[model samples]
Target: MRLGPDTLGTLPAEIAQCGYDRAGQAIGVVHFGIGAFHRAHQAWYLDRAMAAGERDWAISALTLRSPTVAEQLGPQDGLYSLTERAGAGERTRVIGAVREVLFARPDAERAIERVAAPECRIVSFTVTEKGYCRAESGGLDLERAQESFYPVLSAALAQRAARGQAGVTLLSCDNLAGNGAVLHGLVREWLAAHSPDTLAWFEANCTSPSTMVDRIVPRTTEADLQALEERLGLEDRGAVFTERFSQWVIEDDFAARRPRWEELGVQMVADVAPYEAAKLRMLNGAHSLLAYCGLRAGHTYVHEAAGDPALRQLAERLMVDEAMPTLDPAPGQDLAAYARDLLTRFADPALRHRLDQIAMDGTQKIPQRWLDTAAWHCARGQAPGAIREAFDAWCWHLADARFVDDPEAKRLVRAASGGGRQTLLDACFGGGAGAPLWPEYAHLRPLFEGRRGGS
Candidate 1:
């Protein structure tokens, strides 16, 4: 039987201790982009907060682009099983923080209404890097505003302002650097285009708290569902599989009411920039490198890539030599330990984090992950060798017909096909040509070019 309120009582006794019985929690948060990561990370944290006696923080999850998640989870009354895997062991938790789910296409007004509600004091979301509709210069990409969440949020905030609703906190759980500020800037630009008064109201009211979220949530597959079903003795199409590790470091700034999330394992820090930089550069940067290099070396998943000696070495070199040097770690934080932990997590054979999945939207991800770190190294007369290799792998991946999905695929592949690696690097630097990739790695440029052509 499908898991729902009706079936809650019938869930195995083993699952009883998992999530608290959220029988009458109010929907205090309206989150956009209902995906596996959101469910696994944010909702999971909220579930713990509720379990610890917070009542008014249940989430009204909304999907902006598709109804697929809502369709799968709605039937179960927004309840789903999170199966955390580590090697041969599995731990299942029935997350209940999602009190309601909505599809934004046909229910945009409803979504706006929900966010405008008095109880909805927090509007949080996890729409990935590309979802921000960011421009090349790191501000809001004004041209892509219509297709972004910014416009939708602007409309919702306008309604709230019109209704004289109190300000709500807008928390961003995406991996972007200064994600909260980024979202805030985007919303401001969006409102500027549509309603300047609403922009004024928002500036006086809402707060976008930056957050650093860490977790490995691979896209759920049928095998995961089958494994869940066998374990629970019930068909749970809404089940999501994730690694046993998770971390959420949020800036301690909110406009209105919020859960006492700090008591529930969430690090409420004053300055999240240090944490954000370290994770972005070391963890996400290495992940992208692994994605490109691993795929080129015939590996399918993160563990497979991490287990490969050559790829593993490359990842370590990138993390310690290239990425870590760029980061100014928090006081007393062990950078080496952090890098080792990431490699250990990456090598977890239970999680099947696909390279193609991480490699998506390379054009959007490159600026923050690679280019920033590369620029840092270049300014010091140091060669970003590991990053160059990863960039080469990305170019090679784009050139391959099998690998398709990057927004800049056509241009990148064209460059890689004819002009080799230099053309691709030149494009990344916006026609700066060989300057960024110069001096330190100038002698090594031909190596990458020769490898790409020879292959």
Candidate 2:
């Protein structure tokens, strides 16, 4: 049956709440960084958990940044829509797993105390790679701009440890190699820096389960809401749309209880390394390549980039030629096939994932995706042409006076290499630059210059 947007848009049978589930149970999980991806992925998994007789998995989604989502879900009785589209067709599901919502901005201390409750057994994060407060070299990045997230997350954990809330698993749902270890270091640094006494308790009690999550969650748009509303025959105050494929791999590090995520397509294994590395290099690394090279060249979405013969060829060459060398073969699965799948998914004509969306926070993401790739090429005595080309293009993107001046841009902005886009090549290529794609792979100029350089 269809429900108007006024009466809380219709949810599929699996996620629909009868009188009791609608009444809401106690909150067992607290999620930081409440964005569309988390709602579409993790909370959706929780909804499945509740439907399968695991009623204690209710989530209290906390927004560590803005009150926007907290405000939207709080008043809507903690219900939202998960809209999935395959081509022109769509499926809408209402999620009832979120029991409560709160913003940390106005009341940071209270927000921590609330989640530190002894019953809140799970503390998960989807704060993206930038949120973990990491350095380009993959440690606790305690720079001027990144201090807030770590200190804030640590403060909350310290409070929890103090309340003897020792049994919670701190799960990180970000895309980074060894994300759990990275966050663990940041949290340890935070506790030592501030609450030394609580450091022992947290160190002894908490578990940061490393995870590898894969999904192409394009930014939500008005069209998503309108299409979903049309399907449900009403206005949806909260609707999140994403592509069909989803994956999660956990390192199985939990000492205390954790969600039964494995029951919902999540892989729990001794080591999530190979799967994570394969995906990161082939999937996310390619995304960064496309964003710098694709978007700079006037491509708006990933599909367009994939469709471009020259760009796609370059993307494939890097993933197979440059990236594949460093990685162990993706066991049981064709690594080439996986790269092809990633290309096809990114090229989804229906998804319309923006290049600009992929392009953001490059200051943080580049060190991991591109710089690391450059290092690999440098070791082989190869020029990082494609990688350097992307870096040069990124420098152009960063070179903008307005963008360069921003606090986040500080790390990326340096004195211009004096030799122009090609010079940063030396610094990045010999290790990050000095690649063949430049001076040799000349086709890069058109890709890097784009219309901005000229018409």
**Superposed Cα deviation of residue 133, candidate 1 (Å):** 1.1
TM-score for candidate 2, please give it. Answer: 0.84
List lDDT for all candidates, in order: 0.81, 0.69
Q: For each candidate, C-alpha RMSD in Å?
A: 3.2, 5.5
Q: What TM-score would every model get versus the actual structure? A: 0.93, 0.84
lDDT of 1 by residue, 1-455 (tens): 88887777776777743356665778898998989999888998888888888888889888877889889988888889998889988888898888888887787778878888888899998877778876655567778767656666778888889988889999999888899888888888778888888988899999988999999999899988887777777777778889988888999889987888888788888889988998888899999999988888988999999999988999999889988878887887788999999999999989988988988887767667877788787777787888878877887787774765876677667776776665765655434443332233343343344444212
Q: Which window of 10 residues has the lowest lDDT sum in candidate 1?
A: 434-443
Predicted model with the maximum lDDT? 1
Residue 134 CA error for candidate 1 (Å)?
1.8
User: Candidate 1: deviation at residue 369, Å?
Assistant: 1.3
